[model samples]
Target chain A: MVAINIDRFVKRYGALEVVHDISFDIEEGEFLVLVGPSGCGKSTILRMVAGLEEISGGELRMQGVRVNELSPKERQVAMVFQDYALYPHMSVEQNIGFSLELARVPKAEREAQVKRVADILQIGHLLERRPRELSGGQRQRVAIGRAMVRKPQLFLFDEPLSNLDAKLRAEMRGQIKRLHQTLKTTSMYVTHDQLEAMTLADRIICLFDGHIAQMGTPHDLFDRPANVFVAEFIGSPTMNIVPITASKAEGRTVLTLAGGGEVSLPDGTALPSLTNDGNVLAGIRPEHLSDTPTPGATARIEGVIDMLEPLGSDILVTMQVGGATLTARCTDKGQFQAGQNLTLHFDPARLHLFDSKTQMRLG
Target chain B: MRRLNPAAILMLVPTHLLLLVVIALPSIYVFWLSLNESTYGSDLTFVGLDNYVTVLTSSYFWRAALNTLIVVNAVVYIELLIAIGMAALFLGGVRYPKIMFAIVLMPYAISEVVGVLVWKIMLNSGSGVLARTIESLGFGMFNWSVSPPLALSVVTLISIWHHLPFTFLLIYAGMLAIPKSLYEAARIDGATPWQEFWRITLPLTIPAILISLIFRFVFAFRLFSEVWLLTAGGPARLTEVLAVYLYQSGFKYGEFGTASATGWLMVIGSLGVASIYLWAMHRRMLKGND
Candidate 1:
């Protein structure tokens, strides 16, 4: 295992910069997932690390040695591409053993290594099958087996599961995670799916618009999103944002709702520090908004039921509040018709405050 | 009435008629002529298997058949090697790929007769450019065009030159169809350039090679223009392919029956070669499938 370090990497195509001044380090044996939306340069960074793409500006080091000028073969890293990139002409056994054969390994040893990797990936029975004859999941396994047989210093997966169906994707994801644990090799994975990033990463590096929004453990991101984009991006169903006006009242700050209501803040509460106006915004998770009413410095909003999405074990309740639509998950299967009036109760501590102008989490 | 279905049989009538007129008519006429003892007129003596038997027994037919095979094999093999070599070189960071490809492909775009004419002027034994240059270099003017074996070899060379670019372009197109990621994967597997070409490029482009082989074989078997313009079946029929032999039998000797028989022989010979090529391809495909 080798520690991979990327120092201020920049990638430009002609005159347009796709990746701008991004830097991160991957510790040996760490599964670091670079998560971002499409065209945010996650794949570009992975390709640069694999030496498939030339780094326009930056230093890349493996185990403390600069390898900016090395070829992909010289870098000692294997990449499993998004499309699996399996050699269509070769059988699964040949595809897996290709790298070893190229390194001039003896035929018998190459076959053994291929069998070993195939067994590791649980694809040994498919060794005789060509890539086109195999299903998408089988092809992906062969692709991964091809990389595993090389036993390189690091492994790079560029959205390897994106092509698979939902059920097979879940199965393969678990398989990949287990393989990483057993191999104990450093790996870099790129994906736009936050769920995959959250599940597979030891630490998630969140990218937005060609810059790293935040880098932390999954819990760190779920608990303390450094900014608003990280908060909205890392969670499913998205964080709900609502505007509120703040004013100092009776020696305590009170937030006024637009629907002719107000909630008083607790004294000395560590909310987002506001400047200029009495205007601000609130971020709340859908799951945190409860149907049951609670007491004390909590805020409650009343609205009309607009829609309901029943997911097993939980029902997503959409409500019209403060001239905007907000979604909240309801655990109690209390029958409620559309257009019925309802109230949502939530803890103020669960409330995330952000500056109205900058859209950054303030406190 | 119900609306008409898009897959109705009526839609095929026009296309079937066109195929019959364009393709079936010529093939049927050729087959009819192959079985007859007839002049250019429609009057035919019903002779069953006579022309086929006579041509099959003739030494002239056998020699022309052997010569046609020789030319096709030589041209296709040499062209395949040269085309693949040039394609590999161009794809492997040869500077100015487009310019080099254009220069190499220039021969294919030129008129065959003009190319043969130019080469004849260059290789003329008496006062040709090559002869004059060799004399200037203190070597006596070499007897090139008048030599039977040399003329055949030179004609074959000219045929290879004319068609090499088409082969290169076909193989190059196939090479481009292979995604770049496969090469990257091979690189990560520690494959050198030559190993990548052998293990990845060559096997993947087998279909392209087969296509090029079929085209070159079919074209080379009837090799008429270059042989006609350059050697005219030359110096004791050394360069006489089946097409030239058929032409002389039909026009010079006024033996239309022999020429028609020779024409049918060339067609059957090409059919045999094509059948072998297709069978080999089919076997290769079946082995891969298994």
Candidate 2:
């Protein structure tokens, strides 16, 4: 096992700087996921760590040794590409044993390692077949098996499950998590899917536009996001952001919502000091909005139902409140028709305030 | 659903009829004439299979067949090697690839007569650029056209050079179509550059190579321009390929029956080679899908 420490990493493609200076520490035997949207340079960061890409400026140390100039093979790392780039001419057995063959391991030992990895992946029967003969899931397993035979200290996965269908992706996700658990090798995974990041990562590194947005455990990211981007990106159905204008009405601060409404703030909840009584963006996740029809300061908005998507265990309901669109997840399956008025409630503590100009979350 | 239009078939009918009149008629007439004994435009007598039998039994017929095979084999193999090597070098980040590729393809774009004439001038015995260069390098000037084997080799080399660009372009396109991720994966698997080329690059290019082979083999077998222009089957008819023999016997010697029989044999041989190649390609494609 080896711990990886990356300090002040930067990458440039000619003139455009893709990965801005970023630093993070990866614990030994941990599955760290880097999550971001397209063009955010998340994959670039992972590729630099894998040594598939050059580090423009950084210190990448593996077990206390600087490995910036090391080639991919010399770095002792294995990568599972997104396309599952198995050698089409080679059979599954040969693909798994390729690295061992290159190392000139004895044929028997190569066979033994291939067999063991194949058994763990439950693909022993597929060894005799070529990549073209296998299904997507089967090919993904062969790709993983190919990596496993190398027995490298670090494993890098570049959206390996992205090509699979939904059910197969879920199954493979579990298998990968199990594999990481059983093998206990330090691994880095990159994905745009928040669910995969939340499920597979021991610590998730959220990135936005080549910068580290936040890095923490799944609970830390979900419960206490450092900024607006993390708050909106980490959850499904997205967080609803409402623009409000703050004003002092008779000494008690009241925030004016669009379409004519004001929510008077309690004495303890002062206006964020960063912005001077100007416009602000308030955020609330869909799950945090409750369906119970009680009245409270946080439950000030009344809305007309726009759409409803029932997900068996939960029903996702979208509603129009004033100028803002709010989504709420209700466990009850009561028929909520379009144009029906409904009262939505939420706790004020779960609400997030951000400066509208800079988009930075305000405490 | 829309019905098929009668006008669409009407538009195709004239071309179909033209094909029958222009192409099908001559093909049938050739088959008919091959079975008859005819000297120029004089007395055409039906001789059944005698013409074929006479051509098949002739000693020169066997020699022409051997020469044809030799020329085709030499040209195809040399062209395949040159094309593959040129493509690899050009695609491997050589300076000014487009300019180099255009220069290599210049021979193929030129008329075959013009191409062969240029090579003839360059390979001429004493005063040619190649011979003079060899002489300057301490090698004596040698007559390439007078020596039968050397003449055949010279024709083969010219054909190789002329046809190389076609194969190179095809294989290069195939190489480009392959995803770069495969090479990345191979590198991560610890494969050396040579091993990557052999294991990944070469095997993936089988489809393109097969296509180039079929095309070059068929054309090389019936090659006439370079051999005719450079050597003219000279110094004892050592380089008299099947196509040249057909032209010589029919046009020069006025032996239409024997020439037609040889032409028929050549067609059958080329078709046989084509079918065998197609069958192999099908099998390989199916095996890949397996």
Candidate 3:
């Protein structure tokens, strides 16, 4: 079932339109993440869904009912804000039970509901404490507990873990994922952090400049990004993109790297029809590059090592290959030194090709 | 405890000297004066609490104290309600915020004495425009000068009008300091506008409200100008407040020792009123730190 179907959604601030005509559907029980850089209108789209922002043009439907004009409460959606947004003067119990109190639930019933949520979030012991008295992680849990007590149709999280320290962020991220697994409520999360998106989202909507860059599952986004932006954005250390010239030779596509290397497209590889000597972009993930040759490896590039950073499990080797600098993640077993000549190999099938002019991926 | 170094003591000397000259010496002098009976060019004979005993036993002193209590309470509470209302309206997104803010604060820009005088003239019984307007509407003369309750009510009104802007500014700043995201969270949590105010805005602004209350309580307890300039404790001295009574005792009757005792009592009373708010604020701060 489509929980939320946003058709041609548009948001405008007077004359300036921030969210263009974008469209998508969130399936029931699916966790959809809107990931992008700052000011990319990811939060705007989430706010529009939460009814905090007015939709300038287009239709928004929740559970097959039009909700463009509905108030946030009428929409029956709960939001966990980036800053937790707990009432500092109220105790944790009161904060969690505020919605119930507003709804005029009986005191015993409200207390039971609040207690249930507190138990679920493991914050029952801290119920008597105020938000100012709670630690950052505890406050975040209280916020989530507050949202949980509502039991709304949809859950909207606006960068909920962005304020937390790294370890707490990861811990809360796992807790949120576990909670989603147990509840299985449809959720939409907005974040600028790609790792959060990759880990938490069942389906990620990559946004760029108010447009949908791509919408797909995490594996699809990682294995086959739809554009140069998604290719560079979805992974750690980012994908290395170098300019290349493409030409057809012997019924196969031949790529001449701008630096000083060559790569031949494998047989039957889907290729964009290009003009003679047309410029193209070749994308390779740092993790995909190996210091030693591996199976299916067809491209070999040589360079002088420029820098090395160790990450306990692996080392990031930045090498100057002609005019282009490429970073490759190698295992820590290798005793690599800067200024040493090194050769790296990659599989041709793992390469991402884009039309340099449009920056859109080509099959 | 660590001893202060010579340089630190040297740096502190100027501040200590200033406090001694400005605060300590005057307080000590007032204490000394309260213990003596004196008139202009008269020998200072120590009375040993006789002035305090007389003031406490006098019906006039008790009447003035009761009047001061009623007037200060009315002014502080009424001003706070109006200030909260104004702050809420401004926070609800006013169109001409700057202009409206300036207008609300115009009373504060005027000198308190001038503001009280303006109110006094505007409400004068026989010829004032507002008084005539009220009388013409068949309210029968609107004579605040003759009736004690009416006179006290007018003083309270004038005090609220003059000092409301300060209270409003503090509460408005407190309201603004509440993060916008909290309101959004409340909205999503099924809070109506009224619920949002009760649960979020009012609760979060308690610190500001308490601070305003403490200041207004202290200032209103020293209420003098509005009463003195308008009624001058007239109509058989029925509208006399502590400050007016003290002024009459010192300047009008030439009883400086009694006036000094009254001054000390006023300080104690103001401090007593302010301590309630101070206690509440301290409790709130301790809870926040918990």
Q: Which candidate is the best by TM-score?
A: 3
Put down candidate 2 lDDT per residue, A1-363, tens digits, no spaces: 449999999999999999999999899999999999999999999999988889999899999999999889999999999999998889999999999999999999999999999999999999999998899999999999999999999999999999999999999999999999999999999999999999999999999999999999999988878888998999998888888877776877666777655554555555456484668888888888877844555544577899988988888889887667789887866767888998777777777888887787788
User: Candidate 2, B148: how far from true, in Å?
Assistant: 1.0
Residue-level lDDT of model 3, residues A1-363, one tens digit each, is: 899999999999999999999999999999999999998999999999999999999999998889999999999999999999888777899999989988899999999999999999999999998887789999999999999999999999999999999999999999999999999999999999999999999999999999999999999999999999999999999999999887778887777778666665556666666533578888999999989888663677888999999999999999987688899999988679999999888887788888888888887
Q: Which digits, one per residue and each the tens of the lDDT, describe model 2 over residues B1-290?
A: 98769999899999999999998898888888899887776988899988899889977778778888988988888888887887777666788877877898888799888888877887776788887787788877667877878888888888887888888889888888778898999899999888888888888888888888899888887899888898777777777888888888889988888888888899899989888888989998777731
lDDT of 1 at B159: 91
List candidate 1 stretches off by more than 4 Å: A256-268, A276-278, A294-297, A332-334, B1-9, B39-43, B46-48, B93-106, B125-143, B287-290
Candidate 1 chain B weakest ten by summed lDDT: B33-42
lDDT for each of the candidates? 0.84, 0.86, 0.90
> Which regions in candidate 3 have their CA more than 4 angstroms from the true location?
A248-254, A259-271, B1-9
Task: Output the number of the lDDT-best candidate.
Answer: 3
Show pairs that collide, candidate 1.
none
Given the true complex, what DockQ would model 3 score? Answer: 0.67
Residue A142 Cα positional deviation in candidate 2, in Å, after optimal superposition: 1.1
Q: Provide C-alpha RMSD values for all models, in order.
A: 3.3, 2.8, 2.0
lDDT per residue for candidate 1 within A1-363, as digits (tens), equals 449999999999999999999998999999999998998899999999999899999999999999999989899998899999898888899889888877789999989999889888888898988888889999999999988888889999999999999999999999999999999889999999999999999999999888998899999888778778888998878888777787877777777766645555556655666854857777888988888877765667778899988887888899887676789988847576789988888887888877778767777
**Docking level for model 3:** medium
TM-score of chain B of each: 0.88, 0.92, 0.96
